[model samples]
Target chain A: MRAIFPAYLLALIIALAPTSVLATDDVEGAYRLGGGYALGDTGLRLGGYASTEIDVPRTAPWHFSLSDLSLFLTWDNGSRLHFFSELEAGDLLSAGEDESLGVQNVHFEFERCYLDTLVNNNLTVRVGKFLSPIGQWNIIHAAPLVWTTSRPVATENLFSTHATGLMLHGSVNVAQHLLEYSVYGDASETFEAHRSNNPFENAFGAHVRYYLTDSLQLGATYANFVLNDLQPIRYNLAGLDLAWSYQRYELSSEIVYRTTHHTTVENTWQGFIQGVAPISQQWFVIGRYEYFGQTQADAGQIGLLGLAYRPLPPVILKLEYRLGEHNEVLAPDGLSASFAILF
Target chain B: MRLRLVYPMLLILCLAGFPAWAAEPLAVVTAPDYPLSSLSLDDLKLIYLRKSQMDAEGKRWIPLNLPATDPLRRDFSRALFSLLPEEQEEYWNIQYFNGISPPKVMASEEAILRFVASTNGAIGYVRKQKVDPRVKVLLLITPFPPN
Candidate 1:
């Protein structure tokens, strides 16, 4: 029932698009006639990006894996009303036997849909489903927006990826430095979109970042999680992050510590120093060496040394060798190739 | 006898040193009134290659780059990156993943000169001979100069 609703709504939008474009004066930056035939303007913005990658495991035979193909639709009806959304379908062309009784699995899943009010650009609150403001990666988290399509291992596991709830965020300039802050409260029943049946827990988190210069930043965040899943567990976590980048070289790191059972202090650290050089205008070379380790525990160690080329601003291709120690079972050593673009 | 002979050779080597590496034309100039000044090896890397967004006097500053294949561009790259053939790749790839775009490239010294001259708040490097009245020279760096 839920899957059919968006399809019907998308159909409705398609039918109404002609009327919207016929009523517009001209095609501009964010608003234009779809295929030069629709009357669309005054409040709609359309943009989308896609990515695909193939990996060869250390021991298994080579195979093709398609991870992502997505579309974005957003609207900002001037000041107080807005909507942003994405529909993504991943892992389309994998060679595997179907496990589920009878489903081809080709449907668009809504990753984000939110309505925001702009209280003067700098301060505002949003309600709906959106990327969590818990850590750095979640804010500019799209694949094309980031240098590497895959995020740091720590970024994937520790930070909350998305949430359904309310978030209050604001920014200010203090003594010439820019500072941005966010606080969010989410209901645990809305965990992982697909697994949202239980409704007995709630979580809250806050993050603050200070931009020191055009190429450097300092940020810190603290979050406490409480759950009521039969046996409740409470976690107190804090993190400190710093980054410096210039030209084709950059250095960055993050440290996260959490306390559980009221006294045990466990910490994990991740960082990397990388450099990018242009071999030619059409062909640029990239190299990176990164490491993240856990203290007092064998937090999995992952390092990627790779190179990439850009055919144009909208297209990028790369080859990388990824090696992980400590998690021998997950990913031993592998070579991967990927392509991504946004339009 | 040996000391006297070695003395002239040492003096000659010093004189031939940097000027040979970075010789400048006698009367070349540049363009673009102000976005950049007193550019060092570090500043060049930060401004041009990094594509860093900066604000000065309410004017947005943008740095441009020469074509990767241009000779003068090779000289500028050597001076700025200071890396051998193998290290430059690793040097730049690290920055790519850091969410920074490399500088946009133009065809020639004339293209660079024309671009900096026409665009507001633009900065670039070119040959001293190519410098003209259309732009402003912010810094003068050469292998050697008459002191």
Candidate 2:
């Protein structure tokens, strides 16, 4: 299996590395060797994050994978301009799949690499490939950062997750309320599909967000693009996302609808609501419910329950169970647990 | 007789554990030449989180923090952010993923004080006792009981 080699390598590294590297003094910062370190006072930084996961579905065997290994290169410039770049190797190694599933031995990609120019306190310009600022999860989808092992279907299925072009983003305070917006357009297929996760081409999108306070946020997104899967199809999608958090509890939800310009195909709408409550400083529980509706297809509902534990700041352990109705063929009921880390 | 003596000694130990302690106040200070003389709690929170980069005057603002485990830093974060250690960790992880890093961390209050006092537009927090006239106090956070 593809996961065999990476499993051995990971085991060997863990066995050989010094435990003192994770000493108390160095734990806040990344482990000294693989940690995020500033390059002197030059404003440049080097850091990386990696995560491996294991999953078991009702219909499939246990799946073990080296999910993501990424490196970050950033420059603050200490001025109005900044540079950020990320190189990712996803599905770097998988223990349970063949080449037919698009799971390669070492799949390298440029997840996001961009340049940002701040015009002022209220306006900025960004150029290059960046994550599409759609739903909340689209921007913070890293495994270790999210609470559960499974991502909501709407976050991925409704629109392209990445855009390659220029964007204008800004935020301003209006009567003590924060108003934020971003507009982006793609002139051509700038990113190679194989080297990047570019699902669409010739796209234009806009996102507007209003923050009543630090705890609450509401946003809307709209995009039009030509799908890149096999035959090119024109599609328009719109979404709304909401997030609110109190001391120990948080709620997030997103709704998306998409349709093709040509009228024969069915339009689809999907949404999911998820809540998380911290049981203690190191542990939390989560519940999520989701629904999808199609014009001429069977509608479906899904429910998930999850528990997460953080042994350290950069490490997370998660266990999740899912139940689905009317979408059993697409997403089988399953239980998955994973260990993820960020550094 | 042995049991009675033991009970008296235990009572003495319990009394010793409940001594009254004074809560330390924290001063958020900036360089003498810095534009602002005082700041709101909202502005302070935004600055320390690296969400805002400039003062109202459009001048750059550099925020500094003490090492994570420092008692003073812990107290300041608790009173201001109302976040636990694990929550703080999660917050930092999200920021890192979004291309933002936490403020520069100094080893001790003296280092933070020195940095803020010497650098223009720099800000840091220290115990009220450590604050000197070299830096301007922008805000004072009254200590809350540690959780």
Best by TM-score: 2
The reply for model 2, stretches above 4 Å from the true place, is A1-35, A97-103, A191-195, A294-297, A328-330, B1-24, B84-86, B145-147
Residue A302 of model 1 has an lDDT of 66
What are the Cα lDDT values of the candidates? 0.55, 0.76
Supply candidate 1's per-residue lDDT for A195: 31
DockQ for candidate 1, C-alpha atoms: 0.03
DockQ of all predictions against the true structure, Cα-based: 0.03, 0.24
What's the TM-score of chain A alone for every prediction? 0.76, 0.85
Q: Which candidate is the best by DockQ?
A: 2
Candidate 2 chain A, run of 10 with poorest lDDT: A18-27
Cα lDDT of model 1 by residue, B6-91, tens digit: 99999999988846544763222234465454454444454554332343343334456555555565556655555322335433
Model 2: how far residue B75 lies from native, Å: 3.1
- How many steric clashes between backbone atoms does each model show? 24, 2
lDDT of 1 by residue, A157-264 (tens): 444466667788756667866677888887635443553323225667888888797568888878777544345667666777666766544566556665567334
